[model samples]
Target: MNQPTKKVLSLFSGCGGMDLGFEGGFSVHKANLNPIANFGWIEGPTDSEQVLLKKNRFETVFANDINPDAQTAWTHFFKKSFGYSPTTFRLESVVDIVKRHKAGENILPKNVDVVTGGFPCQDFSLSGKRNGLNSHKDHTGKIIGDEDIPSIETRGQLYCWMKEVIEICQPKVFVAENVKGLVNLGDVKDIIQKDFSATSNDGYLVVSPQVLAAWKFGIPQNRERVIFIGFKRSALTPEALEALSMEDIPKEFDPYPKATHTKPVKKDVPEELSETKLSDILSDLPEPDGVTDLSHRHYSKAKFMGKHCQGQGEISLNGISPTIRAEHHGNIEFRRLNAHNGGKNIKELQAGKPQRRLSLRECARIQTFPDDFEFVIPATGKTRKRWDLSPSQGYKVIGNAVPPFLAYHIARNLEEKWNLFFK
Candidate 1:
């Protein structure tokens, strides 16, 4: 039997959400059940703690981060969990990685089957400044530092960097994910086609962009993102492209699967039959204290004090959560039970008032993170106390991630295509 092809890499990997979804293709032990496994190697730097908590085992290679604070947190977590440092992981900036690779100092490994990433999307987000190819803000919204501002050639050019990495790595298949707004960026579609056309690699065909909803997959959020898949021109046969061109790819991709649970718009429906609600994701979560003073120089742990814990009006367990936002605080507060209420839980609380804001754990749950996944907190001596994770950071990470279930479906489809093409 021929050896099975193995190896995968991810870029701009935030909290390993995309990596987890793609890894679902391989059989993994999940709470006593073994699911199909997919990843053999994973890379990227953000949220390494969450990735380390996963039961799946694979060679983790090539994690990178530009932020020193993020790098420090990642290293601390890796040391605490794995007892050693990761090989091939770098604390260097991504631009430096590209430059080194371009200089022929770092050659990517061969026969890598897949490359995936959720590149920074602020420049391309419809909800953002609409700067298109000239945004000066980084993904995190800080004004571009005086020293880091880009020239016209590099402004809003991160997508071009992704394209460069793909060209250099030459993976059999690549998946680039971004906000749905990426499709509308000034002449982006034409630019992508033009860029791909310029490559000499044969049979490389970019799949039409797919707008996928997280709820359709198993995630309990209504996030939508655009996914672009490309097969090396050499990997696709002439017949496949001919067939794809003839058959309208978008038509086949439409009518995406429906959410397993749908949220109810009215309170008249029976509570038992209502779709999933915020309470379902947060009922077991501890309450949050209103404490917000902490030094930014070091990680600090905060105690979870029972402040508010009630669900806003009637909620369903079957539907998706409202979109989590970083800046939403007052109106968007998730409802929590009033302490004065005799009821012990949110469901028993009186209806009609706005719910308390969602806790970080609840946000994580809604984002489809496993209940046991650990978020890094400040450590005191040897014990790491559970500080109330920052709601803003949680919101940013959750808001930015591609729903794992959506990624799973996309990966599964691509895997099928790989088998068919390589057979």
Candidate 2:
């Protein structure tokens, strides 16, 4: 009966990957779980190894990010997995923490209960430059300096400042996220779902914003984003505001998350729900030159601008990678490509293993991050002290994160409908 934790707060929390999927105990890869949703907070070994998971009931307590290598890989992997307190991660700039919490400066945190974000999807990225709300940068991702003048803190309206931090932290669930090309960009997902159902005053209700698909949850990659969520109209429950204002939501009030890995659709699936392949989590990594795990001894020599570029080809250890893009030189792709540029792994080019690229622990294990979460830390003695994160900032905060097993199935579908949608 130890339930009560639920605090959260995140917000563009890069290196924490939706705060390690809402504070769940880590260690993924047993072909990314789901022996038919038997997830009783998982545990160790067997479906062929790895497992663990456990920990949930949320927690984070607050995290931010203007990215100093995402606060040094989220304060060194949350002070080694949840002992946190590196001032609980606040490298500033959610527009200067909402202008220092609107000038009064108690700067947030008071009964928060979930707020999560992903917010800066590079102007609604379709591999960027769509420039939705005309963002020339600001909100600290820089650029706006032509004598500045782009309001509502740009970066395509930072989810309207994550709907003003869910109208000043009144979070009975918030969520946010972006880039499924912000729902085809035209109305910028119906004007950010009508300014997040006019939050605080309109009292919030939101709902219709889905997308998901990180290899349909088991996260082998090919990404996709979109989320949103909302909720707090005086904190739900009138039968969860009529099963979340219906239009389909009644799978026990669906807070979205269902596809626990799919793709091989051929009638009643269940080869442990298929999919999940990029060699089922990098076929037990070992390559990376004498790896003493400085994020697997680093990679990306870059030069392979061919096959109609854009991370120039290669990846497909039996399909599932592609979208891990917070990008870095030659856009980081190949993990083997030599046969005159079309190199399809042919057993790692007859086991010679050369033409590198995807390392930074194979793009943080294809974005499900967790080789004891240490994305490169090499600065050391002789008075030099500077490299706590480089492999180009660990491939840009593991391609701007959020694949902690697709945020642990959206935080285990909101901790399994939080008491049927709040009291």
Candidate 3:
């Protein structure tokens, strides 16, 4: 039987990570897979192994983001992988899109099944200023004019716009993602959840939000994001409605994906599947000698400011990487530090490679974007196309993205029980 594709509308979609994961049909390192939780992906060769994940039952009918570089990267990857027309991705702010939509512009597609958005997270990110709902930047990331008051249009409150899209599209389901720090910032998580539940006169039943750790889903980064899932009450079956309303969701009806890999703990876990190490994913790549792929050829050249500051620490090869920040310049962590800088990865140093920050390719791999998803592009190179995205742009987009591999797990979990949840 042919599985029906769920039409998805993506908002605030930077570089299409969630879109790619939901659509599925991408290659990833073998270490990113679990033997117990097979999603019907094709395994590659034992030597330098990879896994080609089966396409999911979801299709992104529409995608939107304000960032031009994100559009460039997303357009390039989507066109190459799935033959999607550039028109499928709208380069507009959700706020503008929603306002135009409210004004009777046919900007949004009809019959969207799933709505997904990782709304602007910087304000709520622990690594950031923790602005929460009182952000000073407008929807396009520009600072609000001194004359204008910070309102729902501000970056921190952009999820409200995403909520607005949900009200307009009325998808059966909607998934909103944000930085984990939102939970710590004084009832902000509750406020967002409540706002989502209030959609269309309490038309949606929102499950309690949960923070998903990327490392748990085989991503080689210590990234975590809180996810909010809301189901259109009228669209759900009776059992699903009852099950989902419970304080503790029954395992059979839980929408969250099970953890595929385990992190290290003091006590051993049964059948403990070790997490994928950063080294396992990156060991095969030759040093960025400017002769390899476009992503590997360039990296952040920000000098280390020392250990006290963020992004100055060196990544441990044997362990997962620190969270990839949506930052560039001096904020990108070093791939290796020199001896004077408390350097590790002595083997690379001995091999005569220079101390450098993680390359665009390395960061993308850590985020589980396939090797083919080019992040960096030089203005003049054989790999250069019509786009001129700099390394800074690459780092920003990559850091802002949800890990596609982690999104794949969410997609598969939803796909596996779609019928059970919906009418």
Best candidate (score: lDDT):
3
- How well does each candidate superpose onto the true structure, as a TM-score? 0.68, 0.35, 0.95
Error of model 3, residue 182, in angstroms = 0.2
lDDT of each: 0.51, 0.82, 0.89
Q: Regarding TM-score, does 2 or 3 come out ahead?
A: 3
Q: Is candidate 1 or 2 superior in TM-score?
A: 1
Runs in model 1 deviating more than 4 A are 1-5, 25-60, 67-89, 138-155, 237-239, 250-318, 326-348, 351-355, 380-395
Clashes of each: 33, 0, 0
Error of 1 at 98 (Å): 1.0
- Give the TM-score ranking, best first: 3, 1, 2
Question: Which of 2 and 3 is ahead in lDDT?
Answer: 3
Quote the positional error of residue 50 for candidate 3 in Å. Answer: 2.2
Instruction: List pairs with backbone clashes in candidate 3.
Output: none
Q: Which 10 residues in a row give candidate 2 its minimum summed lDDT?
A: 41-50
lDDT of 2: 0.82
Cα-based lDDT at residue 423, candidate 3: 98
